[model samples]
Target: MMKTTKRSDRIDLRIDPKAKETIQAAALLRHKTISEFILENAMGAANEILAERRHFHLDAKQWEAFQAALDAPPRPLPRLERLMQEPGMFDGPEQEA
Candidate 1:
């Protein structure tokens, strides 16, 4: 089923006079209203930021190596084991309340 979403919010901002002129000229050049141009560009930028990690394109050879790494068995790290064994501040003797 398709979902219908409403854009019922407003975002108002004040830009420098020169900045506003620049954006307005760009929008006119693109044959779009200021709102449309701003929304399209902003949405494109937002998607790039948010979806950066959500999509990955890998060739077959890279995919094979990635799969092999994930398939490898767990291995213990000696340094990590030694660190865990060492005493920490939390390991101090507890005092009665």
Candidate 2:
């Protein structure tokens, strides 16, 4: 069973007439209102985009390589260490307003 939630938020779009017509035709083909079609497709696209950030899959060989890299000893970065030891621009005494 699917649970329904009250939709209290609204989104407005200013689309070109041709775009609107195309969307309307597609929505009709799917037997959904324009709002339903747009929301469903947009949500699907949003999930795909966010999934890249939230989850990753690796094959056995790739997983082994990744684990090896993580297990490797830390490398020395003299320049980076020197840069970190130096005072940054914001580290100086604050100037009066």
Candidate 3:
């Protein structure tokens, strides 16, 4: 099977002259093009925004519980061995003749 790659659509955004100059200076200092600098910063901002949206926001007690779980000792159950060897529940029911 073949897969198709996605391409970016052209976008135009306006910024102040000072901001553009600052970006150009930074890009030059880093030996990157303005587009590369903008895309890098945009991707970082997108990741932060997306992570914020997808993560759970915990309160003090919940945070303590989460931390406690992380610090707690691991326990093993005998049933886990049986479960690990068995076919998954998702395998579905038997087929009829």
Candidate 4:
């Protein structure tokens, strides 16, 4: 069944005239609606900020295993063929519900 929920919610913002002008000019240059441009720019900035503050610590043996997996050649899963043949698993023009 398809989801009946809506993911978007509306927001109201107040900004200095000069800041708004700069944002509008950048959005126009990018050929996006003001909201789209703002959301994309904000998301990129957020991801960068989060990346700088994020850290991961792993024990020596776990770290070695992680590195080994990364170095290994990719392997095909045996179940993939059966899964692909199953009906109505993918939602696309080629697949009928």
Best by lDDT: 2
Off by over 4 Å in 2: 1-12, 92-97
Instruction: State candidate 3's TM-score.
Output: 0.51
True-vs-predicted CA distance for residue 8, candidate 3, Å:
4.0
Writing each residue's lDDT as its tens digit, candidate 2 over 1-97 gives 9999999999999999999999999999999999999999999999999999999999999999999999999899999999998888879775799
lDDT of 1: 0.92
| lDDT tens readout by residue for model 1, 21-89 | 999999999999988899999999999988987989889999999999999997989999999988898
Better of 2 and 3 by lDDT: 2
Ranking under lDDT, best-scoring first? 2, 1, 3, 4
For candidate 2, what is the lDDT?
0.98
Q: Which ten residues in a row have the lowest lDDT in candidate 4?
A: 88-97
In model 2, what is the error at residue 4, expressed in angstroms?
A: 6.3
Work out the TM-score per prediction: 0.59, 0.69, 0.51, 0.46
Highest TM-score: which candidate? 2
Assess each prediction's global lDDT (C-alpha) against the native. 0.92, 0.98, 0.90, 0.87
In model 2, which range of ten residues has the least summed lDDT?
Answer: 86-95
Off by over 4 Å in 1: 1-5, 59-61, 75-97
Comparing 1 and 2 on lDDT, the stronger one: 2
Model 1, residue 59: C-alpha shift (Å): 4.1
Model 3 lDDT tens row, 9-94: 87787999999999999999999999888988899999999999899889999999999999999888879988897888798776
